[model samples]
Target: MSACNAIASPVLDPKGPIAAAQTQLLLDAVAIMMIVIVPVFIMAALFTWRYRGTNRNARYAPNLAYYWPVEILIWGVPAGIIFWLGLHLWSATHRLDPYKPIDPEVPPLRVEAVAQDWKWLFIYPEQDIAVVNELVFPAGRPLALRITSDTVMNSFMIPGLGGQIYAMAGMQTRLHLLADEPGEFWGRNVQYSGRGFADQQFRAIATTTEGEFGAWVEKVKASTQMLDATTYEQLAKPSVKVPVTYYSGVQPGLFDSIIAKWHGDGNHLHAQVTGTEQAR
Candidate 1:
């Protein structure tokens, strides 16, 4: 395969600030580890050559048992590296949390994502718009995503966006992200679902300006298609490699309804959706 075809992962080509930060962290960790790794490898080669049986004049101490300095060099160095690694992990975990909001200066765009049988359904509740296998938003604006699954377990991931979160039936998960510049990024289900899992992919377009994003929404709204209960039921069915689709209108509270279905009782679902559920 050609080099272009072989390089398909977006994690290596980050386009967002969060992804860039993550990439830096990975590089830093590897570089720090090599400090000890490289020296150990070099010492191994040197010791083997210096202590070779062919070297008749080599000095040897058969009674040598322990050396405090050597012991400290072996154990202390690795312990210190592990300590630094722990500190970095703790800081990164909180700083890059998926639930935390991005830049406060830019108003966040709310998006509800549903992982269906073999496709992605993105719903814009504020705009009353829904699309299948396509996600579009304005660049430089924070994106707050509420994700869930209608059928089975799945994961929602955009490699250029940094983190991947699970979307489970009956439970809602949150992810916050933003695109530093305007461009199209790849999104897919990293977790295996079923037969159509390989074909499950989507394009996430980040428009350059708010006006362009507004125009795109207007164009979608002009479509005649509607996503009511009946249409949604059909969309929830098993399918493979579905094309991008647009819906001018979406049913109200549709996302909540999908989460409620797995709760069994209506009250529990309501409480869970409304964030009022308490420990039993």
Candidate 2:
């Protein structure tokens, strides 16, 4: 369902160096673009006032000559802007590449994510754990996510953290994010995936310590539902505004099996179970 929480806002917080750099880049670009845009408007206003019909002394030269320096000033400025933009673009791309590892002293926490019909499935492979509707990570630590999709393409995004990465069947995309503070952030599917697109959302809880994360994982593992193949089939079906759920134990490599089937590749043949749940 739509996860709109008013408690914490990630965009307003600059927890790490990358986030701060990104914010500065945005501000600088806006300032640079406005240089030409503002002056053009002022010149247009001045020309309109000075060239009014009543002023007979105003030169009405219909044949205007083109000045090379003025042409260069107009064209070269934009070209320089484009070059500046390209440099920043390349720097950010290399820095944010999902596969690229973070600093050795502060490596990103690994997270495997799967985007399904109308929900998200997050698995912490190191912990041998899974959560159906919620995801958690430690603050001030880099997060490396291995993301993929089930039926259609979806995007994994947390604006407070960083850019959105696509989750498509048969392929894996990487995303790196970090939060400096302990708070709950919002994550959602930015792209339409199907019937319940609008309701596809989840909670991204950023905790302070490993102990707290371990405790939360233990609580999730203590849930009553068994997340076997059958249970997953029901849970994966299209459902709108479904409440958050946790499964005690999940079948190993269930996400891989789904990806295999979706790609039509003969990786592993898992039985497909159909359900009558209404598509949202």
- Work out the TM-score per prediction: 0.88, 0.87
**What is the C-alpha lDDT profile of model 1 across 198-278, one tens digit per residue?**
878888889999999999999999989998766887898999989999999987778988898787764443444344223
Task: Candidate 1: list runs displaced more than 4 Å.
Answer: 1-9, 61-63, 265-280
| Residue pairs of candidate 2 with colliding backbone atoms | 108-142, 109-142, 195-280
Highest-TM-score candidate: 1
User: lDDT tens digits, residues 1-280, model 2?
Assistant: 3334623445545555556667777777787888789989999999998998888888877887987998999999889888888898788778766566666677567778888888898877767677876889887778888899876899988767776779998788887777778888777899987778887888889988988988888998888876666676677677777677777665666666667776675434244312212211
Residue pairs with colliding backbones in model 1 are none
Candidate lDDT (C-alpha), each: 0.86, 0.75
